[model samples]
Target: GRLLNALAATGNEKYLEGFGPPAPGYKHAPLNNTNVVRDMVDDETAGILVEPIQGEGGIRATTTQFLKDLRAICDEFGLLLFYDEIHTGFGRTGKMWGYEWSGVKPDVAAIAKGMGGGFPIGAFMATEKAAVGMVPGTHGSTYGGNPLATGVANAVLDELLKPGFIDDVAKKGEYLKGQLEGLVKRHPSVYTEQRGMGFLQGIQCAPAVPAGDMVNRLQSLGMLVPPAGENVVRIFPALIADKAALDEGIDILGKAAQSFEAAKAAE
Candidate 1:
């Protein structure tokens, strides 16, 4: 797969270790965040890579315990912790960085998505000790630190770090999850379950209902949700979204699921 290819190019040959696909009854499923990292990493490994909460991988949330274990393992082996918080940064997961929820910090991390607040931007931060060998000009992006991009990113961060901004995101995330859970309970025929942390949520629909079909239905209803690798629909609304907006969005999703079910029955 593309992921395997990309990883290979960056870090030499790597093997495919299967991961759990988000689906029916995943809430009770064993959390394997740390286990997977341990299985793959050893003394010679430089670092462990992870997404505290997987976005495109269907809003899958890594457990706090798993994160703690990863931190411990990394210390044990003198390995760096690298987080891909692209979709979970900028208070998207009710925190400035999703890794904070795990009470674990990474030596190096890449962040984007919410950092732009609709503008295009990306960044990678690292602890100097872990970046010991990354000399000047070792790696560069044509536009990585352009003045304009930096200015815009600064503005976005200014707003996000403002007092109560992240707290509001946390409140709204809980409220949104509450609403989605309600819908899941009310429409078990359509949604088998829900999983995610903070605003990065997913609704697992029937396996018979392809994720794309659900997204298209939601789009037709004037709402947009992204699909994941499995039969999961992702909800990555803006960080500033309020309860009212979240309620409306969830309502649209519920209706879309119902519509999909009706159409499926017809078929």
Candidate 2:
């Protein structure tokens, strides 16, 4: 947690107050800016870690060119490139892996969340060269690689790898994006923009519409959208949801916005 706090640029300071300082040497840079990252790297740097699409940080996505530049920078500096794919793995982003969007593979990747299809399991994968130091005894956990978790993960993969499954996700995601854009246009007083990819989407609230208020309003109306940083409301539907389900969600979201606008007018 401390290390994550150090690596994160926002929304981590409160949790780190009582904890001693986070591990040293980790540096942070603005998202999608390769030049800032290049300037921060030096002889002491060992690796670079990033999320292809930030989940809690308002669902911001890294540009393809920025990812490519990071790959090239890692090669030039002899540093390992790492990806935190916990939120974007297992077809969440309409791809088997989020890094697929950039075509720049990471030397190491941390994956979890959807890997076990609701089962509690997490793992880190590395290339053969990057994993040279991980011998049999070097790393072990009481429940790591247990048969049940691995079995569940394999079954999940089997379903995810089925023909047309990922493509359907992509198609539905585009449809959802278009609907969200329409929602923003219709409710200009409540929402300013929509962001993110695939099932992971965020609706940025207008300055007068607090994300927390919108989340509560949606929940009261039989919906549950979470609040994210920068006054964005996160909307992650189940991967198996069909167009009908998505339409229902969008309808509820629109109603919530309409209610907010009504209240504002009355005020």
Candidate 3:
């Protein structure tokens, strides 16, 4: 449906043969990468869009090999590779960009979520050639590059580019993941497993226990996590969060899971 909508909006014949089944995990809703590129899009004209780390799609991290293959495929077809790293950029993924994990360079990339630390901002970065066709006035934004926003973004980038900031994000993310894994082990009935990478993590729980209830419970306990696809709780703490903050958040999450387990056991 999404691809169809995109194709319809573009009104380009390029999407005719660029159709592929869903990748491996979605066998029930098969969307192959090749079919997507070859049938639904014009091999030479259309661009390939992907989320390096799908923040809302259950925090699913794309496999390194899959990303590399996508890059290779895009290069072969003269297609642009675009990465939607809105939620994974600015050290959130323990790297400056989530695509770094796959060692793939996208022709175009979009980011926003973590750029302003909570302020509203959206950004798109592209290779010189990818943006070459865009003439001045072809696109303009009232706030896209406002001086104030630009200054803030510059500061954010400067801070993130510091030698140890991203490295710290990596270390803290590992710690958080380990803590969440332990919680899963201790509360097996409430959580099935831990998934995701960097500071983006999800706890897959039983469907009977609504993610809303968990979110409310965590909120009551002074913690906030988002609901991911299916019945999972997504955790995306600020990259600047430290060990103590992570521990506190994990404790709150563990308590919430235990409470859910107790309620389920009673039922």
Candidate 4:
């Protein structure tokens, strides 16, 4: 628990205030930098934890080479590789796991959110060797394995695993990304670019257009695009959204960007 808090501290100094001293074993490295990661590791290092696709950090996705390098580094140093797949797991990325895209597996992975299908549940899966020390009584939570939650997760999995469901998600993601790219080109004054994959997309607002302003504008247009770090507006659609729904959302997004561009020109 303290370790997780310590890890949080590495993300922001404010996280450590009133939380007492952070545990000393963790280190933070820039995303996609293999050199810094390797340099940071040593005899005291136990593992590396990362989000395959950073959600709150502005929808930044790790490169395939970066993940592969992380795995290689972990293996060379006899350390574990952990993935925080809370956002990118369970078909959000058009794959069962975001790490699947890189073909690099983690020794342990923390997954939740979509897995529960709106139910409250979170879990960590470990490899055989990683789980050796995790026998009964080693670790757990009060509501760790609630039957109702597990049942709901199973029901959700049934739909996600159906033939062509994930493939269709991939197809839809490409379509969404293309449309967003076109939006960026059409309103360069409002949006600089688009980031992310699958249903977890983001449009980065230009410096002249704050992400919060765009989010508010979209919300008023009957669409909800949440703002993320680095002036990004996240466009996470429901997995079940069809082409018509996506087109409608894209149209609304274009409208929002156009409105911002128009307001800027008016000034």
Candidate 5:
């Protein structure tokens, strides 16, 4: 839950002002700042939307207090609270929902990514009370209700909810976290620290090493993971991944880190 205040993905409205003029009235609280959210609420404010675990923003965890405070603020203001759980949904975190750690239920939530099981599918859910305004024609998608997509999503959801599935994911995640932390300790010249929950995790590369360079090094060693903004290499593994698989990834990371350290020292 070390949510630091960082800008959003580049070119976003709040991120460098979308590389142009800003939107008329859009506003955002620094990632972990509670005051911004509080001050921004008013008659024109709709609600608050956020990612419990920021995947692209360096796998930053949302503090339990921060999430709970948002919930309380929304309730007090008679406003909706929404969650964009696409990245952290479906057991990416130890919990089924990133907000579940705080036990705050959102009025509306959007989910996708892992839910599709490699297919293209997405869904938005609103509590019965919050859904009253989202009538049939109010909002819909061209591919939203496809039978095949729904079928695949259902199968994926069923597997994720099966007994002991998420528990195993949590166990694997702890193991993986140890592996990443080990890299940080043993290869400090390359990675400064490890952060994240479950299979969704990241390691911050040192200033001397570029995250993209580390990513290429890992890929060359037979592991593939994307780079998160602000020089982070995300450690995203399959939900059903095992020790051997994670060990392979860690081994690759170790080799890559050593290589980067050696290169840095040479420089």
Candidate 6:
């Protein structure tokens, strides 16, 4: 489908194989390592595009120090910093936006997904200066400005911005995280410590059990977790999910892990 590959640009090997090399204007930086960022960027570089918390590339996060360093480096090098918060926005990361945790603002931000409250809409924001080149009448879309989409989006924003809505998301994320950590302790063979913040988390599995295998098992248990790089089973829970529901989901995943272990032992 067009939607499946529209988000298609990555330095990942699988992407390289499928898409035949990355686009010309991009550079790859190790998630939390700014040295690689410095080494790869040069005078010709226009800006840096980063994800505050990686989703499909695995549940990786950038350290606050690294994010701060990027801000400083981008300033020194005069590069615009863009954040792809498509997955981390709208309370997915417990924070209104994942970059908020580092206290570093992006010059431009791409956001979507949960922002629609089940409807489909995505938008990119830029600081006034950064947006100067985007003349008002030059850029326009047909379906993009449709009243129905815009109205639903506006209503969704009202709910997301309501007092204590974001706070509850952060607290629920903590609860879910604590439960996942317990699973790691109980089944060290099948799992590793959780990766990710808030409601977006992943369970790293050992090579003995592939992440795809766990994804299959979890599907059977009524959970539809996705797989990420380095053998990770990702769980992206709804922002409004409560502690009880999160616990039940995690419990089902734990049982799935145990079942996988037993099946492996029998082999």
lDDT per residue (tens digit) for residues 131-151 in model 5? 988777787777779999999
Off by over 4 Å in 5: 1-24
Listed per model in order, the count of residue pairs whose N, CA or C atoms clash below 3 Å is 0, 0, 23, 0, 0, 0
Clashing pairs in 6: none
Q: Which 10 consecutive residues of model 2 have the lowest summed lDDT?
A: 1-10
Q: Write the per-residue lDDT of candidate 3 for residues 159-261, one digit (tens) a residue.
A: 8898899988888888888988898889877787788878877888876777778889999999877787767889988777888888899889888887887
Question: lDDT per residue, candidate 4, 64-170, as tens digits?
Answer: 99999999999999999999998999999999899999999999998889999899998899999988898898888889899999999999999999999998899
Would you list the C-alpha lDDT of every candidate in the order shown? 0.76, 0.89, 0.76, 0.89, 0.83, 0.84
Q: List residue ranges in candidate 3 displaced over 4 A.
A: 1-45
- Residue 158 of candidate 5: its Cα lDDT? 93
Model 5: worst 10 consecutive residues (lDDT sum)? 1-10
TM-score of each: 0.85, 0.95, 0.85, 0.94, 0.91, 0.93
Candidate 1 is scored at a TM of 0.85
lDDT of model number 3: 0.76
Clashes of 3: 23
> Candidates 3 and 5: which is better by TM-score?
5
lDDT tens readout by residue for model 2, 62-128: 9999999999999999999999898899898889899998899999999999999999899999999
Error of 3 at 190 (Å): 0.7
lDDT value, candidate 6, whole model: 0.84
Q: Provide the global lDDT of candidate 4 against the true structure.
A: 0.89
> What local lDDT does model 3 show for residue 58?
70
Q: List the residue pairs that clash in candidate 1.
A: none
What is the C-alpha local distance difference test score of candidate 1? Answer: 0.76
